[model samples]
Target: MKNPFARSSRNGDDGPSEIYGYRIYMVALSATWASAMYGYDSAFIGGTLELPAFKTSFGLNENDSTSLSSNVVSMFQAGAFFGAICGFFFAEYFGRKPVILGSGVIFAIGAAIQLVGKISALYVGRIFTGLGIGSHSFSDFGSITASTRTFRAQAQHSGEFRPRWLASKNQIVKAQKNLAWVRHLPVDHSYVVNELAEIQAAVCQELELSGEQRTLVQILHECAAPGVRNRILIAVMLMLLQNLTGINAINYYSPTIFRSIGFTGTSVGLLATGVYGIVKMATTAVFMIWIVDRFGRRGPLLVGAVGAGVAMFYLAIYSQLSDSFDRVPPSNSGSQAAVAMIYIYAIFYGFSWNGIPWIFASEVLPTRVRTIGMMCAVCMQWLAQFIIVYSLPYMVASIKYGTFYFFGSCTVVALVFAYLFVPETKGVSMEDMGVLFGPDVSILAVKAQENYQEFRRSTAMAATEAQQEKQGGLHVENA
Candidate 1:
């Protein structure tokens, strides 16, 4: 496809299709609010704590606020970690639409709890918000078949991208119905028939290879499966490294980050932090629309690591040389440059770690265990994030200039990791993920496509016979 983000109807065919339509974008937009809400609060608590009014209301002083700040921020991450784990399980049981809607409702309630102006109430609210986040959608392209997720949020809305899952459950009719509806084709249409046939065949091959029931023991065993295990490892490592980039450190404590680089005054630090957020927000859009697919995952990860690492190193140097927030409110040119480096870092991060890890993690899993595998991945991400947010305040308080250095070094390591381990997933088919990662299932997919052809032929023959019978009956009645 011209937009290689989309897959062609034919397997292994990288041609264009009409699938990348508006409905897809709308559903993508709906899932976005989770991350949007999550990000807002990750940045919100720390910034709010910096406010003189907030401190007064919360019974805290600015000088002794690090513990309080960490508690507030870390609580959210803790909730998020657990919420994400449970969300995946529930999503598997109930489906995505409920999880998506429920999380929003939960977050709204949590947000309301925070408005009560009491610390205990605030903590509970933060936890509620965490559950609502349940782990964010890793990438924008959730399902080509699920463009109407937003519409589903309305009346009678409960369908998602579940072809393989449905096929695995042997619900061939249901899978066919869904695929036909999503693709705007008849159930017997070649595109719909072919897709369902391939999906069924893939599931069959998976079952034959595993030779195990969909039991707890077997699911656990597949975790150690040759190809599946390696992809899981990659996902775990990527999630770990995603947080090691210190994006959350900036996110949770941007005001503190700005101050460490010699910017003084609450308003001044917040202004810098605001600009940093703006840069991140804008760059994220650019990455999603064009860079993610065009430049591909590996290139952005490598380049972003290089660029963001450089920016971090600069901030570290600036933090070391400057008066370290002892300067006047306006700040010096070097201090200004440090602020600029944070924005520079945001640009790189937004383009790279902000979304790539999630995308890659989602892409690498097999169909059957995709939900559980993603649950584990999401847990790792939140666990790492929780650790970062909980420790960053103390890291800044104790290490001072060393905080930037620590994060800067992580980026260098991230650069090496991306270079060594990350595979290029752009324009790759789902079947190819198994081949690329561990199991060489390309032969299986080929055989499956062959089976799909047979299925199509048999189906057409059956339809022709049924039509013939109908015509004979009509002629007899007329006579």
Candidate 2:
């Protein structure tokens, strides 16, 4: 198989035919900028809270600081909760790119508002930023899946861009060009014939099973597919586990975590967090491009869960053994080790729970319910995140090192969850999900097998035709 990351050669013999090319990869990468910004903002909050100027401006001191900091983080999450609620409308109205771009704009404005140094402005700004971030939650991996399926389906049907309805000739040509770019095919490439046919076949199969005339309510609530329900449950479970692991608690309170580990100076804590941010981004990059597909989702998640548990356990133990939460550690080694363990936890998180939930949710759902399913999953994610962020300060103040104990326990549960429920979605195409998760795979498996067989036949037929044409040209030249 040709490597999916590389652009297909013009000769058609150089790249993996089974995978996609640069265009698709570019689209996938572009979509992740939303996630990147989300990480940046989450990390930014911790560093900002550590700023003496920020604390003084907000009238914060050690006595009332934890409550104020929690409020700031919680407010962002609260805004995100409603933003997820509204994302359905935003996506339907403006589409994915617009929603993401708009979110970036809103987030930027919120950041600008925060620079003004007032609590009211800061709360309002955080809400706007949350709305933007919440809006982006819908545009993650699922958005890429939807776009790929739709573009391929449309390109297959529209062939050479004959004007449809009110669409102009220029519009038709532009659409054709764009679709060609996405598929990494020349406008008239013969390869598109098989690809389109396969997409159309899968789509027709789904419509037949799902029906074309059902009302939206019937589609969402009345459908009875054990596989579909199972898939949705997996997504929800993953999202729940993601928040329960306390990754956000760490992201939203890295300075506090650092402080608890005995970093007395705010600058020192912030500097350490900046390094943490770098590690997170680098790990996330490696996971996205290589690990997720290569290793599959379940194993990494299990490893990550177990790894996080160990790290959190160490942190919890070290914190418990320490003299005080607010004072510098009597021995720097234990505190330094605790800080290192946080970095280790981030490594475990980056490769697993960080983005796999979105990828799995997108991959596990059939086209019919993908939008609604993703919407609900993201909403749950934001809501869970809100609860975690809101409660973290209290958890820290009341229980101290016990916060890590709670998250460590959740990681153990997460391992079980992954083992029991999470299916391996590596290299699975969007349309084949029904077959993968169907009530009786023995029956549904044939559908995918038949589709593959048909695709193979098409490839062979095209190759034969190309060979014949080449031979005919040789004969004509001799004559």
Candidate 3:
């Protein structure tokens, strides 16, 4: 079978060799640990906070324990929210590679501090970990000393992508060279030159459209501009709706809920959780690799949201009818269906809400404000998560079935938001994003755009070849 990675998806581009594909995959594998770790750390930390020794060490009684536990677990998200904003400004000044390294340092220090086994240590550690995770993050929950071998190697391998994004302040000056470096082409290669021009045009067009100075304040100001503000709002809303999908509710609540549904033993609950995670991972990989580019983002999002919403609604209805908060013997069809719905939610959420918002946010923004704009979007994401996590317990306790209904409702809203607001970015160019959002571009238009650009480049290349031959003949006649 032919390797997909070896071929270019974009028109007028090629040479994405197997080695390049492998390297790109490694970078994603290493640096994109934040999303996975968010779940891992929350689950582990919830257990940690519940440990008797941990409570005693913190000098907490039951009354204060719940409050303190909420605070401890939520501190990470709070830090992550601010960390994203800080990382953006930091990334702007320092560059991509440095911010990435700094995030590791912060996360490592945070992870190490938590081992001190004090409440203070936990607070600081989680905050730092959150900061690390705010940017170029790989969340390693294991021992930091041992990490020097494994995660460090991953980080080093991930660093190979540095040239592709490191030059922030001087992006234009270095764009051609960076493009050539990644594409494994000479700077003069037509492919590299053409892609570089697209990038440059994108940057220039954004600047011209905004007519704003390239400062942190000015960029934020530009975001308030009519066109930019609406896109930013869309990104924020998509991210917000993503968290509202009851995915995290399951992340934090599933053990208890699953046990309630007759998976009562610790081992059984863990096994159930493991399977859920596996399902999410598998489906998400499928969606990202096979579905995303082929079918486009909107269709999968609508489909997944509907599936998840249906699952949530089913659980809500079952929770009401079965009254199965207390564990029963593992023999009821209704209870099993409730339990299965959680996995079903994971499958749907994993494929859609789990990944699409981030992709949409990144793709919709232009280079001028992409860093800070992403900062805002990511901040909104973490803040939404923190809000959901902190409020979820009370919500589950107070509303019970309505909790699922709330998430289910959000999914319905997400469907409408996607249909009306989210433009298909599948074939859109960065430079044309303004137009795509403003005038509304079609998914099919990307092919036309690519064809036109290819023709334009081919014409330029042909003219250059003819001119070079003429010059060569003139030099020979003079000689």
TM-scores, each model vs. reference: 0.81, 0.80, 0.78
Top candidate on TM-score is: 1
* Cα misplacement distance, residue 245 of candidate 3 (Å): 1.0
- Tell me the TM-score of model 2: 0.80
Question: Poorest 10 consecutive residues of model 1 by lDDT?
Answer: 148-157
Model 1: lDDT equals 0.73
Which lDDT tens digits does candidate 1 get at residues 239-346?
Answer: 899899889999878888777776678888788788888899899877766457678788899989999999999988877777474444346688778777888899
Worst 10-residue stretch by lDDT in candidate 2? 160-169
Residues 1-479 of candidate 3: C-alpha lDDT, one tens digit per residue: 77644543344533324234344444445555555656577666654554467678778887775467567767888888888877776766776557767887887889999989787888899898888787653112111111212222222221223343433344665766765654556788876565566555545566676673566567778777765777788888888999888777777656656765667665677678778878887888777765676677777788998999999899888876666554363557888888789888988888888888777776677556666677777888889989987787667667766787898899899888787777666645444566655433332334434544565578689999999999999999999
* Pairs of colliding residues, candidate 3: none
- Native-to-model Cα distance after best TM-score fit, residue 263 in candidate 3, in Å: 2.1
Q: What lDDT does model 3 reach?
A: 0.67
CA deviation > 4 Å runs, candidate 1: 1-20, 135-162, 170-174, 186-188, 325-330, 439-479
TM-score of 1: 0.81
